[model samples]
Target: MNKIFFDNWESILRTLVITVLAYIALIAMLHTSGKRTLSKMNAFDFVITIALGSAFATVTLNKDVALADGALVFLLLIGLQYSITWLSVRYKPVKKLITSRPSLLLYKGEVLNDVLKKQRITIEEIYVAARKKGIGSLADIDAMILETAGEITVIANLTDDDSQTLQNVAKK
Candidate 1:
């Protein structure tokens, strides 16, 4: 129907204006928040990012939501995220609560089945990570870690000191 496909000119113009302003506001906010705003997102950061996107959409499309309201929401979320990250850096307990710990998936060419199962990571995922890192065989890998942000880190040809640096993650 025409009603389903197109809104009136006023509605369209309102959307156009709101969209431009909201987009500019989002860019300004991201710039103000620092590099961490776009850094690797963990669970909590992911939620905040999603919320910001949804708020922006609401401000753009919904007639009842004002640009000022949406901007305030964005500011509130960004502030909270920054505060948590700041506190987590100085406090071990806060860090543990806010972020996932790095986990070891493979050690010394051995696929750690127990860790994979516990972490709900599959062998195929490990294989895919290895392939992405250009690893043709497991034997060539010294360690495979599932980082806190859910990215796999492939450590190969590690010297004793290099391996020691990863010992903390060996236990999940």
Candidate 2:
């Protein structure tokens, strides 16, 4: 019963030391891996972020797992992310495989029911996004895009410029 509350001074000191060192190693590796390592740009990136957090926690709390082993795991995961992202940037097939295309939910003030249904998005969510963007009414919104990062981008009906930015977004 006592062990449940207090293990020992040595164990506590080891945990503290390991936590600081592991954290420093993680920060260093994240910096070396580049900005993409920390970006939540797509689902794959999100998974890597979650895995990193899980690994950090395990390493901090599990004394059986050595600090060197934890650092190696961090390095491996970051290296894999870097390689995948590097390939994705240079290859069209890799990019398509790893990420989803942005989708157009509303176009020309018309709600695309098919797209909304396919994406499982509600009309109320669209209204909330539009209102957050300072839109007064649905008619004032020219386009509402569901970005790859799962964010709703509300474009106002007032843009006079050509929509070159939306060329790649799936409109269905």
The best candidate in terms of lDDT: 2
TM-score of candidate 1 relative to the true fold: 0.93
**Stretches > 4 Å off in candidate 2:** 158-162
Worst 10 residues of 2 by lDDT: 157-166
Q: Could you give candidate 1's per-residue lDDT for residues 55-141 as a string of tens digits?
A: 999999999999999899989988899899989989999998999778988888989999999999999999999999999999889
How far residue 15's Cα lies from its native spot in candidate 2, in Å, is 0.9
Give all candidates' CA lDDT scores.
Answer: 0.89, 0.91
Which candidate has the highest TM-score of all? Answer: 2
Compute the lDDT for candidate 1: 0.89
lDDT of 2 by residue, 63-139 (tens): 99999999999999999999999999999999999999999999878899999999999999999999899887888
Model 1: lDDT of residue 148: 80
